[model samples]
Target: MGQSSSARHRRNLTRPSQISSSMMDGSSKGTDLVQEDGVIEGHDYISSIPDDVLSSIFNNLSTSDRKISAVVCKRWLIVEGQGRNRLVLNARQELLPIIPTIFTRFDSVTKLVLRCDRRSVSIDDESLIQISLRCQNLSRLKLRGCRELTDVGLAAFSKNTKYLKKFSTGSCLFGVKGMNAVLENCKYLEELSIKRHHGVLEPVSPDFIASDSLKTICFREIYNGHCFGPLIIGAKNLKRLKILRCMGDWDRIFQTMSTRKDNPIMEIVLERIQLTDAGLESISRYTNLETLHLVKTPECTDMGLISVAENCKKLRKLHIDGWRMNRIGNHDGLVNIANHCSNLQELVLISVNPSSESLEELATKCKTLERLALCGIETMGDIEISCIAEKCVELKKICIKGCPITDKGVEAFAWGCPNLVKIKVKKCRDVSGKVIDKLKARRMNLVVSMDSIQIEPESVVDDGGDGGDGGESEPTASSSSSNGGSGSGSVFNTRFGLLAFTFRRWSIGGGGRSV
Candidate 1:
């Protein structure tokens, strides 16, 4: 107790000499000190990094990976929330508890997809209000299977988020009141897509205010949506409209809209609807129409196209389905459109039997035609393909599906269409593997190959040819390195990592990186 400074120093110096041999030399494995708490010991190096750098790192990861990164630490969670622009929230019942936290973190979100599980408690008005309040800058919003949402929530959204440009709601229970709320409030609304929604079962009478900013409107699987006269009248600048699987007097609506002198409707798509020749006649008034798609509208005949051809001179893209081989090729609607619509560039025909004369006329008259798709036309033989190849001088891409064309037709088509860059064919039983390989070898500069490899004559039909974008095929590991060639239709995969990095850099800007 009374030791002097020298004695204390001497004791400290002798302490190392008195250490246990097992601990000092590490001779006995059991003698080593071990932590029993099962905790990992590591410095928080990732969290220590600046927020901007961490955000940059997270942006490189996929959406799923970003989610995993968020739970790594509190700092990562904050970064993920603040930097997020696009968010997809599914399984509402499970996420309901942490939704408020998510909203608080992702204040910068612009595009949000909210899907509610219908079997559980649907996302209600409260949830919609919370989202509208949190994401004020939201430009695009998709609400799917949200049966509990109502007009009140939509009203709140319109009142709070005026910047909404595009909105899509599917499998919802909202009706005309909800639609009115959005149309009335969203001043800058450009596009609206509604599917499997109820409440517009009857005619929605027009109000005084008209939406001048609306450009496109789509209705799918909506019951009695055909009586959308008031909405059509309100959207004076409406260009593109798509209606599918809805019942009501669409003919009357088209006739009503035709009366308006300021109508600028350009693109119209009707599928699985009760549109007849009378409705088709009404569509003819919009001479400025460029793209028209009619599917499963059996009531439309030669007379309908004749009426449309008289006025719609600016037509460029045309798609028609539900044509029987005997009905279509027999001096039917194709002749009228081919004769009238000279500027037509892209044509997609499903279950159509286009006459040889009509085909010849199309090849000659529609000199500007570039893309042609023939689907489900079993009768389309070598003659039609040969004629199209020879006549359509600027034909770039041809998608043939469910046709019974043999070597003669295919070879003729390949040889005739000099400007052809890509050819996608499916369910042609007669085409052999050798033929496909030869075509690929000859046109190495072009994209020439068959999807779903088969050397036999009999093959199963996978799907109708996707005319637009030349039937996108899955990318291969070998094809990933090559760039899209000089040809217009040669599809190539861009490295996702580089694309993400570029987008991150552009979105965050140079200043954010320094943080």
Candidate 2:
């Protein structure tokens, strides 16, 4: 009986959405839907509001709720569509038949996504050209799994959509030629992100000249991404860059970037690559860097850390995942971070072995530090945690995972960091509820979480061999995540949460936040 009533309710709600284009044209822009007295034929009186008022309300609503409002009445549908500035359409071949109609209804869209499932036939060049004509005002375009798109289609669309400022595509077949088309025709393009692009590995760096207007570029899983070295070097005004799992001779490229005099990079994320101390040495040349995330890097050493500390004193957020590699930094090299980069606000060390002396130094010098996460540090015992509790007075959020700290170190929190409010503890077997309660009792406002955090599937990284330069052939698929239970692997599993947690926290540069 309830299912029947639910089906009937849906039918009644959808009846109002059957309005045709002729009816929409004939209806007064500000008038009520069914009656001039602000009463619908069978719907509520709420939508009787003026078009501007309805649009204002829709603007404040979330995208899902606005979609619901669009189905209420013809006037509401028109107002909601007008207020909708971002739209994502399924880029299947079937959608081509109604491209004109869809664009006509949502004519004001400024950010558009053409996404198709891998199993379906994607929209081709003709559809892209048609979309380009309809969405001339689009500032951001994301193409996902659109395998039918090619350089010719991209160039054609690029010629028509000069207003585009941000372009992101993934699982698409378009290569460097299509990528260059956007750079050439889209004069205002400032950001470009490409993932899994099959044909970008062949070396073409010498011919590429990126637009000076570009500010940010991100590449993910684009093997041999170093072929775009000229593009990166040519982007004179580029400020932020993120390239992850894009195997290539990035170390050499980093060396090349350091030689430029107009370098303006302020934030960068380099992950799962063949990064080495040479790249870090080159990165140290970015004197204005404020945020840096070097994840899963094994070749970097204390010299790189010292170089960055000595040069990029303006850095506010720093994160490094050493993956149990003790070579990343030690007492002398890591101490430079605290001694020179005094403005640091947030620090995250994963699978990194830092000495107690560096911890004390960091707490003493980086007084402005507010958030800290130390995970998989085998030697981070009472001394290190004590240093954090005693000196990091401004600290608010802290996460300690898979450390050997005992109840004595845990007890230090009872009187330390008056500003501390939240703490997350995981895989610490020595922590007892009695001491936890004592700390909570001492700091009445503090919240302690001892949850057995589990690893997320997407957050796991397999120990892969050192990355190599992108070859001419395309890459194959591989799964990189694993599960953990009550055993030896549990330690690594529970610590995975902190890996994602700290990465997210450090991504927020100066609290203003960066992507």
Candidate 3:
């Protein structure tokens, strides 16, 4: 009896596969599992799950992934629509008609991005207002290339997103009034970023300044920064501040802003703005300052660096780019930094000629220094390279770009820097494949990265080009992918790479996004 039952169990399992030939031959027969009592049981699959349970599962999926999840069945579609709380919608004109329905389905969305192609027609005022009216729970909103939105729509939309915490807009055709309108309406905002937002006769209004609640603010390519001086000055709790390519007397603006007493500012990134030593001197008041990045500010000399080092003793990272100017060298700025900023960990110097004396001081006093980058400095050669290799015991990653280092300098790390694990070399004329191979042979586990974007360095100390390296607050530009792909131009030396990286990294809304 036991053997017969076992044979029956085996037969039941093999019956489904056995009937496949008949089904392939266009048989009308149906397949169903039948119990001994002759009752048929259909495979309910995932559809049997309760709607609430399915909604919970759908909530964890991304907008695109949830679309796939919704296709499981009719009930799943409703659950996914109700559970989705984050969305990115393409704002092409043709899709404008369906946006209301889409927002209705994803009514719970709190974070949203409406992006439009440059050549495509973007949604206008009505569409934006309608979207804001529906997604009223929105906490974060980003609009890119939606040029038709005027003050009327911006005001209406801001009213709806009362809970909005983060707002980012770029390339929008709006003046200071429209920008301020959002700040006035969205009282709950904590982060704000604006790009290319300017128009004539910007109605000056400071009563609705959002600085009190703001922790981070980034302005890129803005022409009229002076108008917003009162807004910046009012930020008592501002932590991270980044300003790049904003044309004006930033020297006076920054100096005034930095003079605020009881300053809690920790990280400050100034790039491509007209900054001078006079402007940077006020940063000394930020005793809590931890990270400082001065990029392409040609006017800032040794005096600015010394002032920061003397006061900001808690500094953990320092990145300086002298750009096309070479006035930052032959001073005690780096030496003073080494003496006072004992906790410094990461340092990147570009076109700022660091003598053996300064590098030696950093290697010796800054025992905590882990990552070091030196690019396009004429003074950086075998001697300076050897000094770093001999000291800097905690050094882990080193990046060299367009420096005058040769085989001896490149190969020195093979025997030095016991904790070193990765090395990056770019645009250097003297570093050879043979030397790199020999160095790699010695350090079997080390990651040695080299790129052949060999653009010749100009002024004996130039790093060729900016290459969009905005280290601290400007994360999008400082990425490895950005460095590898663009802003440094191409291997053939066109400005296309720089343009591409510039748009990606410096676009105010998406750039300096370290809030």
Candidate 4:
């Protein structure tokens, strides 16, 4: 009965005339006061609230939500007039017609975020020019999936927004030519992200350098079939740089950037690029680096990995694929990293064979490690895993996919690591169903996946070759007494028991078999 009345109240509130002068007064509380002819009668709703409170609420909403709320009524539209430091208009082509109206109302917007759906809306030159003219104070602009914005629109923004500090354009079709004006004009710009864009014309001019204020820049998927030396030279003050799928003259780029004295480069990310020892040596000159990610670099070698470990002393986060590369350090790069980079907290080593001693060394030295991924590692056995479980107390998430570990590893991990919350052991052959049962019994959240239903061949055979001397195996009378009712072999019973136990344990939240 109460729910029905509440629904009716909500329906009445949706009506245009439900808000009236009486409702504005403090007396009426039960019903929504309204006039007879469906007209809202109240002035205090807008005039009474403080401007600061209204602006705070407006800033909290997303770009689209703000646009919808702005057009509800004259009073709400007037609320847009309040000075807001940041304004985000994302994916509302319907709101495009109302941009001028919003601009006329709100003249004090500083940061503007424009996100459009590539399939639906096309942000043409006129729209962008209008925005540049109206929001003159816009210092930071973020455009995502805006395909229609060309060089003309970008030029307007560059020339108009003199104080622009940060700009991010993602999934756009424009290239370096469109951004030439901005890079040349926006002297105060600090951060820039140009991701997944194509058709790069040559940079403006070698003489036209990037703003010294530029600190963090990302050039992702900038496949223009040319070197990025000119672009890198422009951003002299760049501290953090991400170069993805732009593998051209990295050696020269790094060597040039290392020449900077005052504003040295710090963080570097090279994902899916072809980097070799020469490239790594060029990168090694940037000794001030803090975070480095080398993902899917097929040509990477142990010499390169060792160069990074030896040079970059302040390295904090390191992520590298271990499968493609053969050697790491003198033996493997893992030992070099453990010796040099003592401050590493987040480590992701893929398909690398880290020895038991090196694993123990990492667990002891990198005490601040919070997230670790040792996927596709065939050499690390139960002993190495146990060392991590015992020493890395702060570890929250550990992924051990494609490792050869059994119940001993799982038991050791569960017993030692108290704060572990998530574990993924996909394609592990030795982990049995009994381990899953033990995990459930301990009320632990564990995700363990097996690749095949067949029992592992290693579990059946004993250490010695003493199963049988003659052609037929011996079935002793004493063994029958211990075998219960079913006289099948102990190996068969263990396998069947594991299968049955796992079926029951599968009902728990995070355990399954993957074929």
> Global CA lDDT of candidate 3, please?
0.72
Query: In model 4, which runs have C-alpha deviations exceeding 4 angstroms?
Result: 1-47, 57-73, 80-98, 105-108, 115-121, 171-177, 327-331, 393-396, 417-515
- lDDT string for model 1 (1-515, tens) is 89999866644442223236435776553233323332223324455788988888888898789889899878788988888877878836556567788888888888888887767777778778877887888888888888877878788888888888888888988777778888888888888888888756655656635478999888898777865668876788999898988877688888888988857999898987888788888899997898888776777776787788777999987777754524332356778878889998788777667677877888888988877877667558998888888888888667776567776787775467778766766556565545666665555444543546423222322223322211124233222121212222222111111221221222223113000
lDDT of 4 at 226: 33
Best by TM-score: 2
The global C-alpha lDDT for each of the candidates, from Candidate 1 onward, is 0.70, 0.77, 0.72, 0.66
Q: List the residue pairs that clash in candidate 3.
A: 487-497, 487-498
TM-score of each: 0.76, 0.82, 0.79, 0.69
Instruction: Please tell me which predicted candidate would have the highest lDDT against the true structure.
Output: 2
RMSD of each: 13.2, 9.9, 8.8, 15.4
Give the TM-score ranking, best first: 2, 3, 1, 4
Candidate 1 stretches with Cα past 4 Å from truth are: 1-57, 71-74, 91-96, 323-330, 454-515
148: Cα error in model 1, Å: 1.2
Worst 10 residues of 3 by lDDT: 506-515
- Model 3 error, position 48 (Å): 3.5
Task: List the lowest-lDDT window of 10 residues for candidate 2.
Answer: 463-472
